[model samples]
Target chain A: GQQVMQIPQYQHVQEGEDFTTYCNSSTTLSNIQWYKQRPGGHPVFLIQLVKSGEVKKQKRLTFQFGEAKKNSSLHITATQTTDVGTYFCAEGGSWGKLQFGAGTQVVVTP
Target chain B: GAGVSQTPSNKVTEKGKYVELRCDPISGHTALYWYRQSLGQGPEFLIYFQGTGAADDSGLPNDRFFAVRPEGSVSTLKIQRTERGDSAVYLCASRIQGASTGELFFGEGSRLTVL
Candidate 1:
């Protein structure tokens, strides 16, 4: 079975601080996508990385795809309370099946 | 522009009861997926439908679960003789065809509680 691992299962940070969550896959991936889910809410699409070693930024958040397409990371700068949620990284396979990670939970307190 | 919509936001039933969860994906989107999320866990893939056909259903938990997408649009997830362990949130998502990212637009989800 293929597995995707995410570290720092939980993180509590103060407003204006920074936060980072890492995701790694046991096998090579065709691509990766990031999603966020608020507490008790549905998951929302954030961004997707296709090219190896690709980095994309959206406002204060930055996402990176590993050069080998086997890992990814999401970094937030000056986190805000609105940034609190569980972040999941999904790996796309050759069959087009998407494998999701366990996700990292982040809590931002003002 | 409507997003994915699921009927019966919450369902509470006893063990051995049968239940049906419905999903209405966005207009013109040809790809739809269903995922289940347990408490303190990320969403797990249940099945995916491409057009009117189920492209992959490897994630279905057991024979008690079934789904259908007859028109290539809306879908229905049917569960028979539900068990207490079946309590969880069922999420539906949709995306456009030939999408490079395949970034899914999700519905609020249907929460099933088998008591």
Candidate 2:
């Protein structure tokens, strides 16, 4: 079975500090997707990386896919209260199914 | 049409009872999925439907859990003899196709509390 593991299960940082969460998968992934779930809300898609060594950014957020396509990371620059949420990395599978990582919960303190 | 929709935003039931949660995915979408998320955890895969039939259901934890998508647009997840451990948020998502680059559309999940 394929599994995606995320590091730093919980993180709390000062409002101005930077934060990063890492995700590793046991098997190669055809594509990897990132999602953010705000407190008391369902997961919302943020970005998707499909190519080896791919990198994409959305404002202060940066996402990277390892050259091997077996790992990914999400980096937030200058945390904000609005960034408080759980970040998940899902590996795309057949039939639109996504296997998710345990997730990293981010808490930003002002 | 706009986004995925789920009913009964919250549910609280006694142990050993049966429960059903509903999901209405985006119009025209061909793929739908169900997932469960415990407190502080990511969504765990439960089942996936391609059109009116289940394309993959290997993530189902046990026989007690079952789902159906007869019409291919809306779906339901049923649990029998539910346990206190069944308390969690059930999420539903839909996509245009199996291998599309577009992100999945998710609805506000159904939170189940087994007492």
The prediction achieving the highest lDDT against the true structure is 2
What lDDT tens digits, residue by residue, belong to model 2 across residues A58-100?
Answer: 9999999999999999999999999999999999877767888
Worst 10 residues of 2 chain A by lDDT: A92-101
TM-scores across all candidates? 0.96, 0.95
TM-score of 1: 0.96
Q: For candidate 1, lDDT tens digit of each residue in A1-110?
A: 33788888999999999888999987887889899999989999899899999999999999999999889999999999999999998887644567888889998889
DockQ per candidate: 0.72, 0.81
Estimate, for each residue in B1-115, the C-alpha lDDT of model 2 and write its tens digit. 5989998899999999999999999999898999999887788889999899998999898999999999999999999999999999999999888445858889999999999
Off by over 4 Å in 1: A94-96
Q: Candidate 1: lDDT over CA atoms? A: 0.90
Locate the minimum summed-lDDT window of 10 residues in model 2 chain B. B96-105
lDDT of 2: 0.91
